[model samples]
Target chain A: MLERVRIVLVNTSLPANIGAAARAMKTMGLAQMVLVAPKIFPSPEADTLSSGATDILAQARVVSSLDEAIAGCRLVIGTSARSRHIPWPLLNPRAAAAQAWAELPVGEVALVFGREDRGLTNDELHKCHYHVHIPTNPDFSSLNLAAAVQVLAYEMRMRSLEDDQVEAPFWGVDWDIDAAPAEDIERLFVHLEQVLVKVDFLDPENPRQLMTRLRRLFLRSRLDTVELNVLRGFLTAIEKSSKQ
Target chain B: MLERVRIVLVNTSLPANIGAAARAMKTMGLAQMVLVAPKIFPSPEADTLSSGATDILAQARVVSSLDEAIAGCRLVIGTSARSRHIPWPLLNPRAAAAQAWAELPVGEVALVFGREDRGLTNDELHKCHYHVHIPTNPDFSSLNLAAAVQVLAYEMRMRSLEDDQVEAPFWGVDWDIDAAPAEDIERLFVHLEQVLVKVDFLDPENPRQLMTRLRRLFLRSRLDTVELNVLRGFLTAIEKSSKQ
Candidate 1:
């Protein structure tokens, strides 16, 4: 599914950014890259910055125009830094990823990135089916070219991973021990209160919400069986020491 | 709220990457940056790469140690590349952002990134209450420092925007107590260990990750100041009972 999505860079000035973009894309499982009228390509600076992702740069397709880059793409999403008055559909990175995945089943999708200084031309943005804007600080909205690529690629990977999952797995359940059952938790609380009273931490006559607060905290954590047993063991040890 | 969340970079080698990281943070509306023992600073390379985000570089706090960097932060999240044997709570960038936001009402929260070459050390990772891992391609998983910052910072921005759009806030700051600071949590651990040994529940010579498991459970709960005091009082009570 990720292979069907191609990253398109239009009129990029720095070859190093292109190399870095390739590295960014590859890190997020994106393979295809299309370069449209970059100022410099096949430069050592790019290869040097690419680190180990030279394979992405090696297979990158260089084209002369934006039309060539998005020729075969069924879904074209252009990254826009500024709000254009065209009133086209605008999506965040995550939403854009979802839209891309939805379109990927039928045909190819292109995530187009514009030049460093200025983003995609008005005409270029018009060609896009959706304009995706990374919500940036209004004052300092200029995002680095590769940084932008990294954010979009990351969203793509996250969306893909979410789709791959059978269901939303509950956290803390994957640990070695099972989550303590309600009965176990109730027993632990009962034992805990007994020890607290014996150790003079809580007065049985007036507990004053101390036990309630503790219960709330522990309940939110959803202690596992091992944690519950550990607590019970500690309580027993405390009880014995107090008696001694 | 965003200002209360900091981006901490430890032992960064290149000044250029630091500058790029500053730019990435500023673009996403995050202002605070703590650099722990970078190799070089105030470099022209970093400034050049930062483009227009020199203010962030100028204001970034350069600390000697990771502890100093995250001194007052209540929530410390480390970026980990590998899946360790220990079953620690791991979150993706989106979930991490949500967690950071949830904790922001109490006090400062930190997002720690490690050295450029090796990433965060095991010891450094253990210090984090939670570990956030970027879902990168396993085959090409190494992301550039600035790129990683970009992804996390972007998520932060997205989360911030989502909250702003909602009519009512997700969580209110009108609570009676703030979350316990990091120093308080540390003190609790120290006191916990002492009582655990005194009661013979934990053999000091063979602790065997017992304290670590306890810390994980408690930290996930984000105990407030009142809860911390109550727990400390209980620990002191246990110690007194054991001596008697």
Candidate 2:
């Protein structure tokens, strides 16, 4: 079950921290690791820090972009530093782990971590279905990279260790049907943006925050594969009507 | 309430580990630290590793022994590696934090950690009224000293941040009364041991596990001050009856 969950590091700075993150993940029985444009990889520093868990580093997949990292993942949860601006479905680490576990049976799930210095960009954050914030001392919220991973990974491990109690269905009765993967969601957003611009509801000259808000609303609902197709068809009908 | 909680490290070998532990504690809103017979202190290495949490390292109280470190604490919880031989009331980190929170209002509480390499000594482990074990991958359970501190401290902080929903009382309706402090509990044990030896119930030549089992039973109950007095009186009565 844990094998299907991937830890995605986006633009991580220090190689040692990457190794440390791998070690943290391994300690919690998580093996899958995906590095998105890491500053350096396969470095001796990372190897040294990973200690005996070098197998995680050896097996870690390196990707050129976050898109490639979370490509087929149906549920992508980004780690965000507490920010009031990103009014998305924000969850604490424990709740996030529960959500991840709930989705794990459906398809691949990704727990995405940001750069060591600045966390996920607003654009990158928008790509995620949910954001998880590790609540820390407000005065000293500078959580070390691996520490954040450790906390989240620990929560994930805890969730896995729990008895096979029924997890509250994330999407009610329709949960058995797979949720649309990231790429499908991305295409939907792009098509929706184009239709909005054509209909003159959204200004092409000044997009403003309308698309972002729309994305949040849709992401929060987590469109299933069938729902995605229906939405796509609806958008195609709108285009046909506009052409007529 | 968090202010009343102290993190005690016994016989820590590295100054850097101490510093990292301080950082972890500070991140989780814990301020007090007690170091028992550390190999090094007031070192730049500790300060460097502490990052911006130097204030915690600066204010940390260095004591000569574990007894001195936990001196007046009402509750002492030791972090232990899973050992089947140590048959005592062991709690996972989350449960330990809840227990700590339940006791925090009564008096000071201590969370004790042993050396980085060997963890708490059997003698040191006996000093704690309760033990907390963080579950890890059994194959690679080499949790870093600071990481262990981070997990426990994080749990403590989470407990503190929770709404003041009444904690499940550790001692029923008598919860309003003060629980016996560590020193008082220690005294009760001493008196009981003496009386047991006098009655030949406990062989003084080889005490074996009798005292340990008794400690576990009494510690699990968490005697209130009044109960402590009652137990002490009962022990005295036993001694008098034995002498007659």
Candidate 3:
């Protein structure tokens, strides 16, 4: 499954970043790499930048377009630094990696990295099933292209190993049942937030961090279908009773 | 809590690696990086490699010894790839990030990364309360120092984001109990290992992974002081019954 993971670099500006990305991929045991219309490749700069992992750079396929880069991939994910005006389906790097690896047994998965100056265009992102956001500091969020690849590659590689049991995040709440799908969770959040605002518990004008914290708390709970439904039903009752 | 997490680099050889590491740190929102006797600093190579993260390089403190680098930190973790002759408490990068963040409220925490050639020495590892091993390819386990930092720094910073709620790991046992101190946990491991060996449950001659897995399980449980004592008491009883 890990071997089926392809790291695609689109219109990369720096040759060194291309080399570094190859090195990062090799170190994590990923072999497949594809480049789409890079400014310069097959250069000494890339070889020097590859450190000891130049073989990955050598085997890397150079394509003319992003479509060709991900033509055979069953799962296509683009790395995006900024949010769009209308949000697309987004996955944090961890989730995206998990989702990609889960699809790997069926077919190839492409993790697309955009150009250095600007990330993937909206049209390019629209082609992807998900956008992976590598959470960075708001103040200095200009993550080097290879550094971003290093993170996602590391996550994907780690998931293949049994060590993920140790790296799991602390969700605070544990559910014995299967977790609800992301769409169901989103619907629950919207339903609950609407009721809270209706009951004056949340201020729509100046919501501040109430909704954010509530999202964190509920997300941390990892609610199952029954639990989510129960919570939503309780919120509805509160909305009706509060009118009295 | 973010401000309290310190990044300590031990005896780095390459100036470029340091610069790359500084850039990696800044991108992940980590500000504090302490170097213990670096070979070169303030070099043009480091400056060039830092790519726009030179401010972090300018502010990084170079210390004479590892002890001095982490003097004020109450929690110290070292990054190691291979197992020592006798294993120390260890965590995968993700768990170490969560654990370090959890300790931030208590006091300053240190995340130590060693040289590109050789990782932390036994003496240096002794100063650390835990070791964080970033899983890499077994055939080519040689991870570049800056790349390793980027992975860990990314993990630590990502945990601070609200996305942790979705990526949380399973702790297995859930008890609303205070987590025991690292030192107390260390002591418990020592006491438990002695009894396990004395009772022949764990053979000292060929210890294998018995103790290593035990440490991982206990650490994952995040036992409190009372729980540690109760487990120790059970060990003592087992030893007594084995004698009979």
Candidate 4:
């Protein structure tokens, strides 16, 4: 089960964090590592920092884009700090592990981590099936990248060890049983936000947290592929009606 | 409740860790901080790391020993990843937070974190009523001292949000009970341990956890000054019996 899970790091600036993350992953018995456009790798610093878990770092696969990083994975979970911009399908680390690995019996899973300074771009985050938030002291919520990986990795390893396969309660009964990938959801957000602006229901300038709050409500509903289209269709209807 | 909880770091080697710990505590709405025999303090590095939490560092109390650090505290909980030598009454961060804050309604409480490398010594662990163990990947279980503080501090903040006191099990029976200060309690430990040693019930040389176990048992009783005196009187009676 652990073998099927991959750790994806996005635009990592520090070689030390890569090594530290590798060490953390190996300690949790997780070995698959994919780096998305890392600034440096195969460097002495990462080697020195990996301590005894240098094997994981040595085998880490570096990719140019997040899409390339999780190419084979059936499920991709992104670790986020609950960014102010928009809320996506969010789960605490434990629930996320449960959700991701429930598919472990089927195929590979990917856990994506962001850069040290700026986290994943909204466009990049749109690729994830879910976002895992580590409960942190909000004052110092910006945890070191390795620590964040360690937390999620630990939960993944623990979730694998437990014999019971308890699925998280479904968000809602919807037309689409298959959850839409991040791209569909992002498109819906774009279409809906645009329609809202066109209908004079929302101001494009000084947008505030209006879109963010709407994102939370929609994300909580876990909009499926069919559901996403339905929402976009409704937005189109609002645009047409407002034009008349 | 938040005011009564004090964070104590014993023999901290790094000033940056101290500053980072302060930042963590402040983010969680915790203010009381005590440093016991820190190797280097009043450090610019600490101020830099603390960022906006420098005021907490400026107002922090420095003490010579753990006893002085927790001088007036009625309860002391030491955060250790479970020292190899002995099994102390262990509570995970969540339970530790609940236990520590439960005393805030009456008297001060201390949360101690030891040197970054080794955690609390066995003797120091004995002084605490409970030990909080933050669960981490066992293979690379070493968490940065500040991160550990951040984890526990976060739990405390969350615990404070939960509105449930009626479910807490009662501690003891006493009237208008103001808990004895840590100084008085330390004195009582000294007197009782001495009397027990004299009575041959405890061997001071290689004492093991005889006194440590006794400390836990009494600490749990939430001894008020009168209760402390009564326990001392009972110990004195034993000393007299042995001499007779």
User: What is the iRMS for every candidate structure?
Assistant: 19.7, 27.1, 20.7, 27.0
Residue A191, model 1, lDDT: 93
Instruction: Indicate the DockQ of the complex predicted as candidate 2.
Output: 0.08
Cand. 1 TM to true fold: 0.69
Q: Which digits, one per residue and each the tens of the lDDT, describe model 3 over residues B55-155?
A: 88999999999868877665677998767765656788888888778767656778998888889987677556667888888866767799999999998
Q: Give candidate 3's whole-model lDDT.
A: 0.78
Error of 4 at A221 (Å): 47
Q: Distance from true position, residue B27, model 3, in Å?
A: 1.5
lDDT of 1 by residue, B127-174 (tens): 566678999999999899999999989888888889443221111123
Encode model 4's per-residue lDDT on A1-244: one tens digit a residue: 7867899999999898898788767767788999988999879999876767777887889888887887766566787776735455667766777776675765677899998898887656655656677666555565668767766776676676565422233233323255454345556778888887887778877776677666545655656667777878888878778853
Q: Specify the highest-TM-score model's number.
A: 1
Per-model CA lDDT versus the true structure: 0.81, 0.78, 0.78, 0.71
In order of DockQ, best first, we have: 1, 3, 2, 4
For candidate 3, give the lDDT of residue B81.
77
Fraction of the native A-B contacts that model 3 recovers: 0.31
Q: Which residue segments of model 1 deviate by more than 4 Å? A: A164-244, B163-244
> Fraction of reference contacts reproduced per prediction?
0.34, 0.19, 0.31, 0.05
- Candidate 3 segments exceeding 4 Å error: A162-164, A167-244, B162-244
Candidate 1 overall Cα lDDT vs. reference? 0.81
Fold similarity of candidate 2's chain A to the true chain A, as a TM-score: 0.66
CAPRI verdict on model 3?
Answer: incorrect
TM-score of chain A of each: 0.70, 0.66, 0.67, 0.65
